[model samples]
Target: MIETMGDQLPAADIESFLPLRRCSILSYGVGHMLNDITSACWFTYLLLFLTDIGLTPRDASIVMLSGQVADGFMTVFAGELIDRFGRFKLWHAGGSVLVAISFSSVFGGCLLCQILGINSAALRTIGYSIFAAIFNVGWAATQVSHMAMVNCMTLNDTSRVALASCRNAFTMVANLTLYGIALAVFSINDAKTSVDIEDQYRWIAYVSILIGCCFVGIFLFGTKEPRLKQQHCENNQRVSWAYWFSKLLYYQVALVYMLTRLVTNVSQALLAFYVINDLEMAQSSKALIPALIYICSFAVSIILQEIKWNGWRLKAFYTTGAILWIFSGVGIFLLPSKIHNFMYLLSITTGVANALMTVTGISMESMLVGKDLNGCAFVYGSLSFLDKVSCGLALYLLESYQSSPSSEGCHDITSCQSVTRYGSGLIPAACALVGAVVTYTMNLHDTTPKSLSEPLLA
Candidate 1:
């Protein structure tokens, strides 16, 4: 009896608790990175591209905001569908095809409108909005499916974190590389006196479509869902809709994450608008700024993983992130009006804060979710959806403020509107501070990194 009990002692090495189905994990990471690359290539440039194609600042705001509005309802409904379907590959394939076709069609339609002499400003706005809405629909659906795949890939927390780290690192690299390509395209166009509307404004869509198509095939070809090994999981695999509903009430981590995401998105969206319209920063410059931030964030994640924390793991991580945010806000407030080297410095500061917020936020969530990971992806999807809602609300509020006459900075960077714009960026930074405080107050039972008596390492 003693020998049997000893043999059955809980796993000491977290990594050993769940052996990685390595092939699946690798395929999953590569697929996710590619999808994000295609999606982000357009995502980072959507607002600027719309503005270039004759959409007014206000109209561009509406187009961006509309996607968020759509996401709110789509996340829950789509997540549920993914949970029930058990066919993530099909959705991945279908969504990729839709994305490719939708994106390619946008350019084709634009060329036709130009040739037919129907390229009026209103028509252009409508065309952009329609294409954006279609692209986002596929994006939302595929994201729900993708999250499900990630959850299914591993039950071990450390493995999942390692996977998340890989995904995020690649995501940053993809964003930087794609943005570099965009910057090159934009730079080339600016140097020439003549502008081909199609080349400058819509060719990236075709490129994104092509990249997405390749990945769709890769993901569909590579993955086969693993059969559940645990009796409890196998027995409960077909969780009823009512089960999902009832469990929703107890998802405290999900609620906290959603609120934090909402706050952060609102702040970031407004900041992007402010930087473009008020700061008058070049598109190439803006792309570079985010690249730097994401790189720094990737570094922070590596550091965060190695550090041994006790009671204050969550507290320390979030508090440091909050401080970076506030300091970055200060950088924004102090930036010189003339765009120059100081502008770059301010960008770096803001970028670092942004990275800290993102990486730390992700780590916190991973820690919070811990072992009960069955619906973790759904929680993530729902939080992402709420983030879009917050973005929508922020955009609406800013647009309203900009439309008003008394608002300063409406016409120039030196006005009250400038202040309003900067203020909006600071909102998320402030919220980060608040989130850190609230997180500390919560009574979460977190395991130390190395507990002598603990069974599993994760």
Candidate 2:
């Protein structure tokens, strides 16, 4: 049997807990980075691209909403398949290729129209939605498999932390790199305005496809899957859907974590809109703001991991972070337009809050799930499903409100500052407050390793 806090495993099982090879861990990190880069490239620019190309904001939002819904459902299926097959590498490789093709197709369709001198808004809208759905299918599959592999790769807590840190570091790097590329490619004449650039978008698609394929090849060829014991495989096979649902319903920490994730996604989806159209910041500022945020977040995460914490400390960290997030939102809304230094400060503060929330939230999730559970992928998938659905709805509502005729006069940066402020600031602040309240009510004392060993229904 596996060891618990007050229980010990036999000597024979000790060998099974060895740390993974460094190269294998690095391969997983690189794969995660590439996946995120592909995701960010489209998500960061798709809405802007559509609007610049003549699609209404509402229509663009609908297209993205549809894709998110499809992705949510696919995650459920992907999780089941991953658990049933015990073959993450196959899913990872296959999903990567599909993601590349679908992602590029989104841009390629528009290019084809331009090349053929066809100017149909309806066709472009439909094409973008279809390709978005296809991309999500691949994204869902790969995300489920990749995250589950983290659990399966090692039972050693320290090794898992190291792996998680590596993934987080790469995430920051990927964000910076993608945003830098977007800035360099899209900013024309330094005018701080949207431009129709089908050629630029097409080139981005080609480059993204090439980069994605190379990283996938590296991951597939570099990493070796860990072997699970027969009893563990049996346990995984025995996990029932009812039990999974029960856990999802009853798990307070997971629900709270999902809420936090939803907040993050909503803010991310609206960020480019707020920065480019509302504040009308310079191109360099657009790229530098987010880059600074990630850098600060990465640094704070490193510090957070080094500190030792018990239940009280964890709660304190979360509470403090929540308060900071709330303040950051308010500050962003109130900050003077075109003030670069103040904006940088605000970005740094937001980044610190992000680091705090993510590190503690993930730690809480791991504690709730524990090492005994064999259906890690399913659990993550369920969370992802809830997160995407909630986020999609939130985005749709916000975009609809902003794109309405009533808001037409407010489109200019000077006139629309309040709308942008609230959309980016007050709304997210409210959500963060709710998350804080939820976190406060959680029974962290009951989340011990012993409690984790109990059945979901019990």
Candidate 3:
């Protein structure tokens, strides 16, 4: 085991990063950061847009839920196609083009509705649903290809962690910066005229398309694949779906990675609802806090991995994130409705936990996946899909209580608020706690030095 470890580790720790055979690695990360920013911008703004476009509670829910369905199906195919074809750049470019097209289509549809005076809720619902599905599908495909390429960038554990952390940090910055920009522009315009809401949104869509184009171009021109021989055998050389699926599922570390992501994403969804409804923060404020939290968390995670908690990095991530999450949940529950300051404090703590988990999860995944398999995208996409599903479930549970016909009177508001609070805070904390427990219980760190054979999938 020790020898295997030695073999994998570069002679110098600095040399562990991908040797620059091509500029693709750097470009891949850059593309991801750009795409992430664009996506976050849309996520932040889209909900409000639906409300603006006359979508009722039911219509908005239908649109998001339907997108989740499409997300699940697309991920399976995206993973398979990337793995079999190995055309990462092509997939990426195509995905970007689709994103531009989808967003434009949505904007056009909304504009058409305004022009024809056909602002019926049903029409808006259909238009939004179609837009949501296509947007997510394109995003998912690009994500798959991008991840596959990232997996090939380097073979070092620490380097991979560093790279993922850097990308995540940039993404967080993008999230925060774009929201700030949106808030500044939207607020100024919002005070001028109510009718210009669609105009403001159309401008946002134009920015989204530009970002998508940047990602597509960055990746298409920047990345170059290095020469690596494919593994071949006498008769079983061709890759099989069963082989990939089994390898992904049965690999010990991959199992751990998958479980952690599910927990992390569930937590993310729950928190989103909590911020908007429970704390009663404005959407822009909620978005800003999360961005800060992510950035701070990302920085702390890198330090923990590299220094203070270096040896037990994963443990630190799990334990710190879990404890903070638990406390954050308690804070949310006990926090007064008007205690916006305390709520943000609690958010900061939750952000730290989330940041740690994000970095650790990426590191663990890079460690688990095969050099040739390109499973990072699959794992990422699958994990991404699961998080969305968990978010949907959390939303369902929260909305069920909020919109329930039975609850009435002043007490009902409290009950509904309680649902929103717990829906965001407790659910994620519980998920993280469970993940920490399961991961720790595995005794993954206790493997005998001699027990390290070549990794099953690696």
Candidate 4:
């Protein structure tokens, strides 16, 4: 009887919880570094790699969209399973293994064609699409598991925010690492032919895999599965998806999260194109400009760690980011190739804006889940579902028109009407304006978004 009573005691002992140590936060934060780095490569370079290797712009976009669609489909299912079974570590490990292997295949080129000794464009597209889809499946699993762990980590709101900031900082680190790798790969090897370009991307992919896997190992070794009290979670598994869908806040969050993702991802997808084909800058600018963005983003993420966060503060920071993107987007559209150096300034602001939106945007998931704990994975999955589909469709549509003539009758990047420039500038700016308006409409507070508890860590 006493043992049973003691077991029950833990369920009631809420206030006794202390903050998560910085080491724990840091360890957990680095777990997703693998996902972040791979995702950065996918968005920033996949189109360029595909186009450079002889795939049409339409075909390249199709490959990217296929991965996004696969990822979107996987997130909700992954979330459902994680919420039901509760082995976050297992899911994370399995997903990491998938990401490492399949991601390499996506960038490594058409193994199917190489084996069969055929050079069909359709065959290559299909081969790349298969690997891209597989990679995203693993990516979805890793992402959902890692993110859902935040709710189980602690009960303190401040610590939750700190954890998020730490995670964002690591994201910057991952981007910097990716660009650093690319710069070296591109610099040391001049690609005089299509085959050479493909080889450079393959090498970059291999190096990124090596670096990302080490961080995943650190995460698995340093962090233990949180002792989520069985009593609290026992009933949570049964929480219906409909319960989440019934709330108005769910829709608001879904829309805003989707918009945020579109803004970030779409901008990234178009950047390599803008810098190379449009701006006609040196090959090195491709890596250097993105490096500058992540450096500034990393600094801002560190400073965000020191803030005392709340609901309104989260919204404010997010809106500030959106507005910044608006200005950057417009600047990107208007800047002619003659002033290409000005892009460095825009990269700085873009990085800061990215950090602000990304950190707060992710935190809102925790807020929406509150103390519900039940099917929290589903909540994340559903949000990601929307994000993935929206981004995929947006990228597909924009890239489809890359070869179409501009209405203004301009022939080159200097005309400021190329699809690359238009997609890079106007798309994100439009999304940000809409996201800001939606953010203001949200009704949020410190307690579990709906009721009572620390707003952040638990």
> What are the per-residue Cα lDDT tens digits for candidate 3 across 1-458?
44555675544322223233223334555666545755665545554455555565456666766665676667668876666556677777777777777775554445445656897777777767787788778877877676656555554444455556656665665666666666666676662342476677666677656765675576577666522212211222444545546753334444445445544444444445556655566766655666666667656744543421122566666667777777876666656546666766776787777677667666555554534343445665665566555555555455445442222312233544466456556666666677666556433231112323332113
- For each candidate in the order shown, give its overall lDDT on alpha carbons: 0.55, 0.67, 0.57, 0.85
| Candidate 2 vs 4: which has more lDDT | 4
lDDT of 4 by residue, 395-441 (tens): 99988888843344333455777788878888898998998899999
The residue-by-residue lDDT of candidate 2 on 1-458, one tens digit each, is 23453255545445445555666667876676557777666666776677766788888888788778888898888887777777888888878878877876765545445656776877667767888888888888887777777767665444454456566666676777777776677675232333435566666767666766776778778877656523477644546667756763236676766767655566666667666555566656656777787888778766664443445665677777778889988876666555535767878888788767766665555455455446666777777787677777777777776743233333334554555567677777777788788778766542233312321111
TM-score of each: 0.78, 0.84, 0.78, 0.93
Say what the RMSD of model 3 is: 5.7
- Pick by lDDT: which candidate is best? 4
- RMSD of each candidate? 5.0, 5.3, 5.7, 4.1
Error of 2 at 200 (Å): 1.9
**Model 3 bad stretches (over 4 Å):** 1-26, 104-118, 191-195, 226-277, 280-284, 301-312, 372-381, 403-416, 442-458
Per-residue error at 31 for model 4, in Å? 0.3
User: Which residue window of length 10 is worst by lDDT in model 2?
Assistant: 449-458
lDDT of 1 by residue, 1-458 (tens): 32333455443323223535545555665555445665565545565455555566677677667666665666666766665555666776666666666765544345445656897776666666676667667767676676555445544444454455555555566566566666667777762321464565456656555665665666677876534323225545544444434753325445445545644455444444455555556656666666666667556655544343333555566567677667766556545435434556655655555554555455555555444445545555666676667766666566544542232333333453353445445666666667667666655544323322222222
Off by over 4 Å in 4: 1-11, 15-17, 229-231, 235-237, 404-414, 448-458
- The TM-score that candidate 3 achieves is 0.78
Question: What shift in Å separates residue 109 of candidate 2 from its native position after superposition?
Answer: 3.6
